[model samples]
Target: MTVAAISWSAANARRMERQFLLNPAKPGQAGPGEVVDAMLAAHAQVMSAAELSVGLRMDGATRLDVRDALWGEEPSLVKTYGPRGTIHFLPVSELPMWTGALSAVPGGPSPFKAGDRLTPSQTDEIVGAIGEALDGACLTIDELSDEVVARTGPWAGDLVLPAFQGMWPRWRSVMHVAGHRGVLCFAPNRGRKVTYTRPSAAGSEEPPLSAEVAAGRLVRRFLYAYGPATSPEFAKWAAAPARWAGEVFASLASAGEIEAVEMEGVPSSWVVAGDTEFPAEPVRGVRLLPYFDAYVIASHPRERLFPGRAYERALAGGQAGNFPVLLVDGIVAGVWHQRRSGRRITVTVEPLGSLNAGQERELEGQAERVGEVLEGWAELVVGPVAVGAHA
Candidate 1:
């Protein structure tokens, strides 16, 4: 079959629109849960950023609204470990799919040596213990560690896996795996401490799909949201083994579940079967994206997405999401920073080039919107941002 080609700008517009970043839904038109569903998952390691990532997409949403969706009666979202083994807010209804697909990822060699690591059987035992521990309850990590240690053996609590300033328990290593298997998820913070609970407690009742089936579905969804991408890019995004991702993409292509594409200046790419259309016009707008925002993290071909000065100023060593970005027409055009003092927030944006009067007004509006999502009054400052990643 002859491969179809797409210009990078059009592809960027399609991806941004699909993620609701190009033209976000209006106030009250979309909810936080809906935003999470559209983005697949909202990166949540930095909870505040994740809240903005979701809230910014839903024009009227506030951080509290996002909190409610995760912790309110009949919660609609689940906080768990997701792609790249990072914290994310995934839709509750899709927990089963997430578990199946994540658990199926082929893990690499342990970062720990033999003595510090849990044996395969020990790992399974610990995972089972975690599910049993968190059933019908939410426990702090220390409290859960006690329960996990008691239910299993002391070896489960052995402090060997090195962490910042100290070693973590053997069981801590499998926390992400347990999260993948639907046995664990985040609960509301207990004061200053984090807590964990089960997916069942979060209103997820469906059993997981088979690994093969779940993986196929996940791949299709990835293509839909971030497609016209190569297997290597998917592998990097998912943190899966390159060989495994290649095999999966090849299988999908052979099964007619995805089709090949020839992107300008790129060797090969694939999109969901029959998903070959692009937006009629390239995306045009000024927007503020929080750190680790899913759209910035998942989009491929960094050179095209970041472009020119953004490649150096916005990105940290070619890694997206380490710094909050100022985007112009779906491309990173500057870097931004935010500071909150009492009920007011100061949003400082440094665009690579001078904005016209119209763009300046739009930027002020965007800054105010960021403050609104954070539930604070915002003051915009157009100046130099002299800080490093995540500063």
Candidate 2:
């Protein structure tokens, strides 16, 4: 049997509307928690950026709304290290499943392989120490380090290595390790320092899903949220090993959860079977997305989103965080940056191509929505930004 191909336009439209980045059906009805659940997780290395990300998707959402979901009592959101071992805001309800699947991804090459440092047994010792150190109370990295030394011996602290953040100890990867062990997690900020806490380890009432089952669920979530994707795309997005992702996709295809579909000019893509409904209206208007927005990262064949000059200007070192993106018609058209002084916020937009009157009008609206999320008066200044310029 022949599988149906999904056009770029149809796939882009469906993804945009469903993710609430475009043509939101209900305004103000969905809160921060629901918005995040829809998108699986929000990139949160920069806390304010993730807040803006959530605010853009929900009707009348504010920084406080996202904050409440994150830090409030009976919290609906949880922050953790995920997807490249960077911070993300995830729904608290799905913590179990996310931990199960994300922990399965293999870590990067370690210097220990050359027997320089971090022997395999020592690595396990540090991971165990981190869980014991946190023991329910939130502790800063410094405090955790001391506790780890207490448990694993002082030599653990001596295992320092060069890091972007000054000199970091070898056990820094233990955060990813602890996360995989389903023990340690990020705690709400205590004063100026980041803290961590461990969850209760009482075994789940139901038997935990095997690694295969967990990986299957993660792959399904990726395609459901960002479908028409290739295994390589899914692997990159999930931070899973290529061979592992290939095997998961094979299993999923055999189970009929997804089907291979040819995208025009694009070699291979897969989408959830029977998910073919197109959007009522075509993708129109403009949007100023935050740095590392899921819309910017999850989409595949980025050449389509960042074509021509956009490929060079909007991306740096083949990464997206260099600047927030300007989206027009469900594709990246430019780059933008925002600066605030007191009550006034200034936005600088650098479009890759010219925009006509209607599109320019949409840009104005985009600025307004951006300001609403910021809770400040926002002004848009369009044109090329000078090299090494500030907004």
Candidate 3:
């Protein structure tokens, strides 16, 4: 395969993340209006608050207008989903199916594993209290925990008081299960409330799609958006169990939606829908990617998406802290830091290697674009700092 094919595959793999992929115009190039148009054209219905910020920067969109345009008018433009139990934006139209697919698997474990302070009965009591307290009102986690304690008194004490640590994971799982069963649905937190609330009852219990069917749909979507991915990469991205992911791929292969490809000296299969095209030639530009950007996280085997040496430098010592990144010529060249002071924002970049004059200019331009999105004047600083320097 040509270098363009490899790059396209990598880009698509990143796009499969959907929420994490931000389609912004290159810096100093696309205007704010054009950026918003590009975002709309990408079929993004809802965007995460952070993802939206990055999107605006990438698209040269005015920072002030970002939230209002995408989420203010349509409150459902951004929300959360997934097994890791983190926040993500899903297009309103796709929420139901996505949630169904995500909630199919019971969350991994609760803090109250085998040995903990609370007994089984006590745990059940705590769960019941939370359910009762949140019956009609939306509450922040803190508020809910407080109410549970007030209501159950001694039992809540036994379950949450001492450390109140282990109870959180279990509670999250319970709430997830409740949401899956239609006992509750997520709504905007607003202020004073928590991350979600009980949404309307309509379309709540449409009967969850089977896991296999859901997996199939998820795989197809990933391949379409981030095709030419290895099974492990697909498994990681889908957050599906390995065996289940394997089975899903098998089913898709049987249906002829994917085909095998060779990478390095090994034979691997990736989704293929005939031929594809590269975005453009000489893909030279700078992009500021947000934390957990799909481009950085997708591709089960990360080596497929980034240079092995660069990955090591980016994630020094194995502690993958969320650091903003600087991408040059379609590859991650270094990491960036953004610090805000009053009306001014300072952007510091630590390059992994020497940058050409063109790359430097592109990086500065991207920083300016980020300033526009953030609605703050920005200063760009570049250096060859060590990987763990800032950390």
Candidate 4:
């Protein structure tokens, strides 16, 4: 089919608006769950960063509000192993879609050797035990380990899987898979230690959609938020095989769920069949994004999002989200860092080029907004950042 073409700048502008970076929800009007739904999933490898990621997208949201949404009596979000097998904050309403989509990803071989890895039968037993153990109860890793070992066997608890500084129990390797299977999820932190529980506790146990249905939903969602993108980019973002992603995209296109698009200087891409809309002007604003922000991580044509100096300053190798980025009009322009003391937070920005006085003031306001999301007073400083990526 003949595809319509779009400029990279136009694509970026549309994506920024979809991601809530261009025009976020009004203060006190929207909740963290809405932001989570927009981004597909908010990375939670760094919990504080995840909170800011969701909070910043909602004009008046605070860290406490994010916390409440996750752990309150009627929680609206579930912290779990999301895409790429990493911790993420998923909207509770979409748990079934997330579980089905994530669990269907083709897994590679285990890193552990024969002796260290759990046998297929053992793995099944452990997965079952995890669901049973976590049902209606929150347990720390150690506590869960003990329960799993007792329910399964000593081999389930054997310390053989090599980890940083130490070896992990054999069953721990399947923990993420269990989460994808909808049997495990994170609970509120117990003191300083993280705890796990079953997602069933947060809501009724709804069955996950079939793999095909789930994959279709996920691909359309990705396109809605970051489209005019390619199968390979979606593969990278979802950690699914490139071939598998291509097949999924082809199926969606064939079914008329999506249509191909031509991006000048970019390979073939697609978007929701009738969803082609771009802003009259490029997105304009200075925004501060926390570490691993979904926009920086998921947006495609890497060079387009992190143009020129931002490629060197904000990214580690070709990967994004290692450094908190400063975006000028939807494109990365610099990097930034924050240091908090008591109720005050210091924001230090390192822009690639000189900013006009108005831009500088806008940046200061962006920094102050960052502090507000974190529930602190922010002081902005425009200068060099001393730290390196992911520091």
Predicted structure with the largest lDDT when compared to the true one: 1
Candidate RMSDs in order: 1.2, 3.0, 6.1, 1.3
Evaluated against the true structure, the overall lDDT of model 4 is 0.89
lDDT of each: 0.89, 0.76, 0.53, 0.89
Q: What is the lDDT of residue 370 in candidate 3?
A: 67
| Candidate number with the higher lDDT (1 or 3) | 1
Off by over 4 Å in 3: 1-49, 52-54, 62-66, 69-71, 106-111, 115-137, 146-170, 173-195, 199-210, 264-266, 272-282, 316-321, 384-391
**Candidate 1's C-alpha lDDT?**
0.89
Residue-level lDDT tens digits of model 1 in 1-391:
6365788888888888878887677876667777788898999999989999988887677899899999999888999999999899999877878899999999998888978878889989999999999999999999999999999999899888889899888899999999999999999989999999999998897889999989988888888988789999989999999999999998888999999887875757989999999988988889999999999898989988988888999888889999999888788899999999998999999999978887788899999999998999999999999778973
- lDDT for position 293 in model 4: 95
Against the hidden true structure, what lDDT does model 2 obtain?
Answer: 0.76
Candidate 3: tens digits of C-alpha lDDT, residues 335-360: 87777797688888888778888877
lDDT of 3: 0.53
Q: Which ten residues in a row have the lowest lDDT in candidate 1?
A: 22-31
Candidate with more favorable, higher lDDT: 2 or 3: 2
Tens-digit lDDT string for candidate 2 (1-391) = 3355557777788788778987542665677767887787898888878988898887777788778777676567777776777788877666667777877777667654353367779978888888777775788989998898888876777656667777766677567767665667677788889988864422122223567777788777888888778999988887778888898899888999887777765646777776655655668778888888877788867887787888888877666655788988888889888888986888889898889999999899888877887888889999776543112
Clash counts for the predictions, in order: 0, 1, 8, 0
